[model samples]
Target: MKTVALVYSQHTAQTAELGGRIAAAWGSEVVYLDPDTTRLEDWMKYERFILGTPTYFDGELPDSWDEFLPELEDADLSGKKVAVYGLGDQQHYPVSFADGVGLLASYMEELGATIVGETSTEGYSYEHSVAERDGRFLGLVLDPTNQPELTDQRLAAWLEQLKVAFAG
Candidate 1:
């Protein structure tokens, strides 16, 4: 199956770094695409997708994601499996931690894709997030700025979750 990682980042490159880790965990041929250079057509060739982005001010995706999502409206992603991940400064934006995850995930969900990588909110200290549903994040939420030490462990666990989610 073809897998791709589409990433968008501004300022800190933590979102890109997280994409790399996810690609590595997949242990397969995974193509990496950055928003500026990535074409919506290129995304259509993949069966599995891993999308990452940094949450902008309050609860929103970066400019690139804003530009990219609408492009996907014409693409048919039915039956595709997607895993979403995001970076955020939970301390500063606790009320909307990794909110872009929700925005992005919603677009994918609308496109008829199945979203994997849902994670618990246990280790996080955020007050609210658009990404949260039923006490769980829509995808993996990592805080390289506040809890860098937990990134590896969280990624490992989420990777395991993806394996199971993808299998059944």
Candidate 2:
């Protein structure tokens, strides 16, 4: 299995918690990297990455992720694999639920990274979201605020898919 780095914003409690859970579920090969303090060179060390973020007010990317955009843009991720997970409140912001995942995935794809682990949108109640493409979420979309019960199951399934995707 390829070494995977789970990158997230440590400042956002929900995102941080989700990142921890993902890392634990992924086992020892996964390393946690906080985007705030992770150097640009550090990002190049891993070819497989799981990025987590909580959608801020009205679908905005959190501050730490927003600030790290330049570094990501500068990095060369050609042939790399990235899976994104985003936290959002589907009940409160249905129109923009988990848009951060889409935004980040798009940027990474632009940088030549192959985005993986897209999930079905069947269980979600969101009206609209940039995260949806071709009727599926760009990656895992967890609504812990309204549907915490489903998070674990969703994470498990997504992680399984990622293992296969990253292995290639």
Candidate 3:
């Protein structure tokens, strides 16, 4: 089985829960990126790396992941599949919840990680959330309010696509 590392900086534990779902779905490993971790190396070492995080107030990105900016410059992810996901509440940060993943996506590209397809979601940042199930990048714009099932199912679908994309 291929390995996909789920890296995230979370507050409400929703991001961590998403990682659990993804791990269960793919039988992969969940690694935290907060306070520096040996798992960051897993990002380059694994066949696929999934960057997961929770959005902050007014679109503020997690401070810890910013460290990735410089480190990624020296890494090589060429043809190595990668994806990003973010979980956030619907009340705050009305927009830009999924922007963090895009930031990671940009860096992954610089490092040569092949971005599978589809990106961003706003809702379903919790356990059993579809984002983990699908394994794709998400933003969570409207979340449970606009479309309750939108985030989770979309996430699950993304995961499914990643499997196929890497397999092919």
- Every candidate's lDDT: 0.81, 0.90, 0.58
Residue-by-residue lDDT tens digits, candidate 2, 36-118: 88887988999999999888888799888888888877678998999999988999998999999999999999999999999
Ten contiguous residues with the weakest lDDT in model 2: 67-76
Q: How badly does each model clash, as a count of residue pairs?
A: 0, 0, 20
Name the top lDDT candidate: 2
| Tens-digit per-residue lDDT, 79-98, candidate 1 | 88888888888899999899
Worst 10 residues of 1 by lDDT: 3-12
Clash pairs detected, candidate 2: none
The parts of candidate 2 lying over 4 Å away from their true place are none
Score residue 103 of candidate 1 by CA lDDT.
86
Instruction: Sort by TM-score, best first.
Output: 2, 1, 3
Who is ahead in TM-score, 1 or 3?
Answer: 1
TM-score of 2: 0.96
lDDT of 1 at 20: 63
* Model 1 stretches astray by more than 4 angstroms: 9-12
Specify the highest-TM-score model's number.
2
